[model samples]
Target: MPRARVSLLSLGSVRQGLRDSIRHLQSSSARASSTSPNEVEHSDFATEVEINDLPDGSAASERIAKAIGCSVNDLNAYFDPADPSTLSITAKSLKASPQMRTSLLEWRQNIPPISLRTERAKKAYRRPIGLNAAFEKALKVLTVDKHEKYERILRLTDKVEGIINQFNVKAIDEIPVQKKRSEAYLTAGLIRKLRIDAEINFPEVTSQFEMGKFDMRLPVYQHLVRARWEKNDRLLLIDRMESMHVIPDTLPTLYPQVDVKVRFPGTNTFWIDPGRVMSTGVTASEPKFSIQMFEDSTKLFTIVIVDPDTPDLLTDSYKTTLHYILSDISISGNSPLVDKANANELVSYLPPHPEKNSGYHRYAVWVFEQPNCEPLSTEKLASFDLQNRDSFDIRRFSQLYGLKAVGAHFWRNKYDSRTESVREKYGLPQGLVYSHKRYQHYEDYAWALPDLEVGDENKA
Candidate 1:
């Protein structure tokens, strides 16, 4: 009995210490010269937490309660009975260990099932308290190193759990999102469709998005690939999500600045070109464009294409095409082959071929001249090519180039809160929550893991 009590106290204290470390790092890492490993681990861990809505009647929860030798009512008491969406355990009231730290295994095996069920709620409540979220909040925490690196071990465990959850691993993945109610099975009786036996498994790419895994992003992009390579029973290649790593965008800086020329906005009849940049066309017959310069003041030209007819098998099926014309201000030449006189300027467009298509595909093409032009080599875009180059993979490119991507256009769903800027949706939302303290920027009960120091890196 004393051993059990000691285990509980150690678990609670270590949890508290971790929370303290995480909060401290999240709050002060930006201002401090150095940050603790505990802090970064917590932030990364918080991201992997799956906030799913638990059913009011969880057979699993009931079975767990029975396995632990606790009465149903006693088990329920330990969890939050009010919010059926979550089982919440209050960490604030728990007893702490005399040593004020706990081992990873203790919490996993010792914590009653009912107590585990309330983890989400407890985590939510403890966000402001500064726990090392990555250590304590994972579905399953495992490690061989537990000396001074206890915090990092915890963070890695969280990451491992998140990877498992992202790929929908049954026993390992425990985080739950909101439940979906789809009655489309009503058409089960009218089932008359082609059958395809397909196998799905998450492939280890970078550890986050397994190649074998099937997620919303994969299906959506595959649909785009189908539309792109239409007319064959070809298989589209999509990599796992783990290939994504957070890095600053680097392209916009290559040029001092370039003018943005608008040629055409997409229309109902035509979808935007994936290869060309959009420009405002002054006239339908002569087609004039409005140009805006970036910080470098280099004159740039653009072309736009809108193709509404592209088969949108996926819910997000609209497409925009961009064609960029960059001119080198240093070069001077007169050429009739091209309307632009700058010898340094080059025109590049995508969907590489438009004339070959028999169907009506709308495309916009605009030309602009920049004060200075920095040529982008093929090697710069090699990753994009490997990743299918075209599709919903726009964010990955913009992120790499440090370019403020002006979205061509996309289908809006009910869940989309248009109030947030596009950059926030694609790039900065997580950063915003992590960087700031005011809760108003985020939602109630929605807290971010504090900033953490990575490896031996000092605070920025």
Candidate 2:
């Protein structure tokens, strides 16, 4: 048999013709079954083809044409305005030949109906027009740009992961202290270099670098965290401290190098926002603290919490009252949590209970780096008492102890429903309710009597 002539007709026309032939075959078989009860039923086609095989376009069309003993060009002509008798004869021949019916059924099964194709596939194959064309082109350009950005981010992330993996081979604690410190410093420098490159080259995508494995000790995360602090947290801290007078009121001036976070355990588990107004009930318990030290080397530090607005009745002014003090706190970049067990508690925590009439009181939390990492002498530690805590002088205390202020955080507290209970719990004196002193009117005073009024000459 001659090879099927290649047809210029679309695949759609070929699929519709195949479907019509299959339908005709099915109807013819049903009619034949009704007419002759003695006729043996044909077995169902055994040749199974997957839907995926239908797209072998031209090759599949050629095979189907050859199986049917016809050319693709002849199949194409069946749809043309030709003699109706010729089309009917061709249909009858297709229905009579079992091989032709099988081939048509197989083709119909493998090729999915047009309605079954996905909308995405339809869009992909469909030609765009006018504004739709422009939109598709723009979409393609955006996809390519996004893909390039994603690849760049992946490369940077891979570099970061490689650096992290190099040092992460050994447990951080197992390493020798000296070697660990040196390695930490070196890793920090390398990570910082990469971070700088990312910021300069792709500032918008720099945040993508922080997507994976976050280890605070690893410089990869640490540097990013530090950058975030500098850009956002640090500025907020300074603005609150200065605007709220936490700077001059508690300490002379503050330049925070480390990040100090404080949270009252019984009240809030999360770190409290700086300069927030907290109620007495929430601030009743001793606060837990986390201090992030940028330096690698461990250093002894002191933490002090003072209420600068403590009421001084006799003086008629406010005085600094030391509410809590912890000395000799060993802190490093890796070890941030304040371990109360190891630190010396110079003064135990005293919850803030501002009196009913007293205004909002500033509770300043100050962190001072101990000079030479020397523990405070027992004499000095013992000297801190209720008497000493009252009217506390933080500046003089820092000077005497050679402590340099490194970090500070504070919040305001005022009289609330729980203040009375807090005062009673601490066995403190009952707060006095103060009122503004009343002044006599000039008309009511004896010195301003109408009879004692000065004459015009006296006025002159």
Candidate 3:
């Protein structure tokens, strides 16, 4: 059984400790730091806890909750949300092992603000302002390999044909916006039809588009694959759902129990806290884990680790912030991540480290079974190459390549001193907290593991 949690900072000292920690931080850097691993506030944490930039306690509490992986409700149970000590105490309550707790502190300290990150994005990517988003999306969809592109063009052709058929006639005298949409769809449909015709070279239409013939058609960017999120509803404990069919339900049984362990620079590796809230420092590299397979060695698998919470928690406006994608594996009776060479790693595993002051996030790993296709063969998997990672949709990716959910699990991570650095590395936005104190209705219930044949592995 997991031990009952206790706070290291006393209530009487919390207020004072926070202030002292803040002052100590301001002396070190322009930012303010507040959390400590244990009762003793570490100087390393002082550099990372930047409360000075935060306007108030509401902001501080939100940051504390996210940084330590506790609900605002949980953090408040120990101290005022704004208090820096709230983070330290809340982490204590969660029983985060000492080494992981310290890494959380360090990770939080290293975070950079939006201004800096935006600046970094501008300098690093040099994304031309007038590059045309809609055109770019269309180009991405159209220019892929023959197999995938053929299917996409067909799907688009069908959709546009239906829309065009809905309009009894080409009402050229319609309003500007309406006419624009109609013409674009008509033109997009025409282009798809034309692409198949050997006589019409690609240059004619593209050259005409460059010359401003049916310019609106350039904006025809449609997602080819849209699959259901069957697992999101299970994660929905909120009183109300903002959008239906956005997230899926959670699986009760993590069929093949996966043990995810984090290696700390300070201490020995430990089994991840069953609760899954982790410090940013501990997540810099890909996590090492051992999976218990169901004696099926022939199956090929794909593992996608994604953070669906970005910019905020309630809605996935930013969609999934992909961290890792390892595909095409031959499970040899029970070997851990095999053949680093054979697997298709679309995105190298960047660890989860949410920005400071952002709401708590859910970082999940989804495992899909490539039953029919030779996932190992690059020739077979060529159709699945998504040129851009921004549009990566796991559900679509799974359905597109005939992969089904085999086994999956996820852990949570929030901001820490090293978070700023991680965010800077990924060119992410600064943490944003719209409101204070997310409810703790589910609280400790989130970690309930289902009973399996190996019963002992069920517990974290």
What are the models' TM-scores?
0.19, 0.53, 0.36
**Ten-residue segment with the worst summed lDDT in candidate 3?**
219-228
* lDDT (10s digit) by residue, model 3, range 1-460: 2111111112232234234434543453433234344423333333345433444667766765665555777556655555543244454643664544553454334333233436666444422222233333444333333234444444555554444446543422221357655564465645444333311223344455335343221212110000111233223212111122113633223332222223333453764533356777667666654333422234567777767666623232455666777877665433544565767786787667665566666666667666553654565457765545444576766656666665555566766678878777777665443445554533323333233222343332
Best by lDDT: 2
Which TM-score value belongs to model 1? 0.19
Off by over 4 Å in 3: 1-268, 312-318, 337-339, 376-387, 425-460
lDDT of 2 by residue, 179-228 (tens): 65445445534434543343332322333444534445433456667877
Off by over 4 Å in 1: 1-309, 314-316, 319-373, 386-392, 405-460
Clash totals for all candidate models: 79, 0, 28
For model 2 the local lDDT of residue 236 reads 93
Question: lDDT per residue, candidate 1, 332-375, as tens digits?
Answer: 11111223344333334322222112233334232223212344
Ranking by TM-score: 2, 3, 1
lDDT of 2: 0.63
